[model samples]
Target: MTHPLTSLSGKKGLIVGIANRHSIAYGCARVLKAQGAELAVTYLNAKAEPFVRPLADELDASLVLPLDVEKPGELETVFDAIREQWGRLDFVVHSIAYCPLEDLHGRVVDCSLEGFQQAMRVSCYSLIEMARLAEPLMKDGGTLVAMSYYGAEKVVENYNIMGPVKAALESTVRYLAHELGSQGIRVHAVSPGPLKTRAASGIAHFDALIDAAIERAPQNRLVDIDEVGATCAFLVSDAARALTGDTLYVDAGFHIMG
Candidate 1:
């Protein structure tokens, strides 16, 4: 077998949203670290730190910080630590999204004003926030990638208000790519098919969504976290330098179905 390092060795990156070993962020971090990219990871809080800290250690992360995006100044603290430690960053992976249970399980039309706003702030605006901080630090040019989903394009049953939230996130990806392209910064959204992630567990009837994806996708199988990770590594690697302002699907052909 050919050893494909994807040429990311020595690249430094910050990964947000790693909850546990099963997180998509963890998967991406795993492959990126394997490709010899140095990593910095985050935990949402003290409780989550217990679950995420060991994985950060296993990945040999140079910096591990608390990062609750909604918490005032916490995001800045993480970036500050990155700046103090690495001086410059080559890439960043943003894989966080959230909505209140009441809003997530309800119809989009019925979603509360506060709930919708909160979801947009967390799931959509946070990318813009991160991109702003990363722009200057990406001095040598870099890539920024975020987690998105098929629900952003088409209505998936039980996805509820997140459909619109993801739609906004995808749009932000394009706008950020345009703004940052001249600086040699690439921005993209990686949309993977349904998986039993901690985030996905919040969706109502998520198991059925996964089953339908497996049955209807061209490959007739579900995508694993490692696959998602490898795709993320590709987007940030030199291999994908020319690629930006687009949503890359790693869904085993599920999105192509009419």
Candidate 2:
């Protein structure tokens, strides 16, 4: 028999921020679908729809829509579609983050005000917005998982402005979990070790970071997208009902090093 905790049958979820096959959001979507969860997947814009559409079809997503958090009404439009089609939601995977090249490649101290604000809005505040919109739909309770990184806690050599942005995201997860627990809603941040996703490509010296993680991590290897997906699959499953307000690490034990 399929374990009740691992099976996501009848559950409905929304995944935001799939830029390509290598995206963290795509990884999460793949596992969730494999676990039998119905999904609603979003693409960033017209430019991204072509790339994401094929993946959505492969997942058999019930709803495929555009969701650019910065664009007015786009977020609400997605939630509205979910409400109309499914009437409820069980989980949401938020895997979006952005910082302009100039800001991301430079020192945090040199980041422009606009760049800092934009990064925080996209990477951190968007989670808050998602939680708010998802709350009403998760009537029986649900889980909210956001992608985070080890750099959110420690200063990595080339992780620059996104470090503080993700720090804020982790804090948001804790606060949201506390506030929503009464409603049976849980929130968490999944921090994966260095990945080779398109988003990670934006970071300067990311290849070096990945190599260092493989060498220093206790597991003596790097975690892959599917591994991260499996961790997220667990997070959004009934087996993880007791876990919330925490940052779960899927980083091959790299976060423990000095």
> Which candidate number would show the highest lDDT if scored against the true structure?
2
TM-score of each: 0.98, 0.99
**Local accuracy of candidate 1 as per-residue lDDT tens digits, 1-258:** 314537688799999989988899999999999888999999999999999999999999999999989999999999999999989999999999999999999998899999999999989999999999999999989999999999999999999999999999999999999999999999999999998889999999888998899999999999999999999998888888788988999999999999
Overlapping backbone residue pairs in candidate 2 total 0
In TM-score terms, which candidate is top?
2
For model 2, which pairs clash? Answer: none
Off by over 4 Å in 1: 1-5
| lDDT by residue (tens digit), candidate 2, 1-258 | 668988999999999989999998999999999999999999999999999999999999999999999999999999999999999999999999999999999988899999999999899999999999999999999999999999899999999999899999999999999999999999999999988999999988888998999999999998888998999999999999999999999999999999
Off by over 4 Å in 2: none
What local lDDT does model 2 show for residue 241?
Answer: 93
For model 1 the TM-score comes to: 0.98
